[model samples]
Target: MDIKAYIESGIIESYVLGLATPQEADELQRLSQTYPEIAAAVAGGEQWLRETADHYALPAPEELKTQLLARLEHEFQPEKQAPDLRYYRRDLFKYAAAVLLLLLTVSGLLNVYLYNNYRNASRDFVRLQSGIDMMAADNKAFQAKLAVLEQDLRFITAPGTIKVPLAGVSGREDYFATLYWNTQTKNVYLTANHLPAPAPGKQYQLWAIVDGKPVSAGLLNPNCTDLCMVTPVQQAQAFAITLEKTGGNPTPTSDQMVVLGKVKA
Candidate 1:
């Protein structure tokens, strides 16, 4: 029932080339009637075979026509008293020309069918290959994303990690964020749990307060929604995030502060 698999199996090619067994041929005929794809595949195969045959077709021998005419004249030679055989000979030639014309007409029709089939098959192959390539690219991307998530999971579950919950400041009560810091390794990671996306040409920057002074940590990547590693700090009394231009400023813009959190003693 898998039409694509069946087409790729080369059974259609075998059937078109007159190489299929009786049972196989019967099955192909039945399937062709039942499925449009199967029918089209069969037509493509037939076209390919015909084109191949034409490409290798041998030219008729030059002496062949002379031999045929001589043999015909001898076979129809008139008796000694009878009139010359010219009239009968003319009729025979006419009949021969008619037969030759019929054969040429049939050959031309076959050529046309084969050419059309070849074009259709080529188009189908291009489309199928494109689809396969796209699927492969998507699969690779998914695997890469899964690997990153797995790494984040391991880091989150490690011991000696402190989780700082950041709450939205002022009117932005709905926004929130989280920061995970590993005290032993001096590593920090941030996640924008419920923060709204920054406006165009702006980004969110993290600041670590040390000895009552704000220290620039790093800028948060706008595209990252999950845990992302940030600048490490050995000590901090508080953490805050503020909106700034694309590249963050040396000092935090206090009015643009979105979320603020303090580290527990």
Candidate 2:
């Protein structure tokens, strides 16, 4: 319905005069609840009527106020009321317990969360520190290796250093050796990895085999895993390894020709 047409009608004036039909009162209640504008208009009209009645106030006498209060007390006086001290105390205890339980649950959750996070953080920190220490150790090891390589290069390149080539032995498929000889200082670096280890109680005697005769230059033991031996060859031509008795034999054992290498001319 168009509220403008309803407002212009004389039903609101008739309702104020207490002459509206029951159907009109119900419709007005519904309109008041449905539309704030209609509610506001009705409230303003009622307020105006109240203000007009106030301006023409025939005030209530003091006797009327006392009589109205007496009538209210007579209408609502209770027949029986219990003293509820214990019951009220029990209710208060229940509410307090509920509040304490809630607080404890919240506190326990927070503590568990904090403990787990603290433990995880501690583990992470330890792992990071360990990684840092391992990196430092690896860096130091690499630096030491670099120093050893530099020293080796310098020692090999020194002046008057003899580089003697020891050729491969015939009939042994992969037998070869080289001697980095430093003749000026009588120091030789034997690269003897291709040679085989001699039998027990029999060592490899390094011989300077010149003109079909074996000269005992020096004896090279078979412990070449960590280091190479440094023995000078005073009169070297062809190299030969012979199996000799314990310590070493003065002459080469003819039957045990384990390795032989001719000197490169």
Instruction: Pick the lDDT winner.
Output: 1
lDDT of 1 at 51: 97
lDDT of each: 0.91, 0.71
User: Which tens-of-lDDT digit does each residue in 1-265 have in candidate 2?
Assistant: 8886675585665566567899997898799799887777677667766787889999789799888888897577455545466678889999999999999999999999999999999999999999999999999999997886676566578775555555444566465566655556656566665766666887766777768788876677577642255567665667776668867777888766566766655
Could you tell me the TM-score of candidate 1? 0.60
Tell me the TM-score of model 2.
0.52
Write candidate 1's Cα lDDT for 18-54 as tens digits.
8999999999999999998999999899899999999
RMSD (CA, angstroms), candidate 2: 17.8
RMSD of each: 38.2, 17.8
Best by TM-score: 1
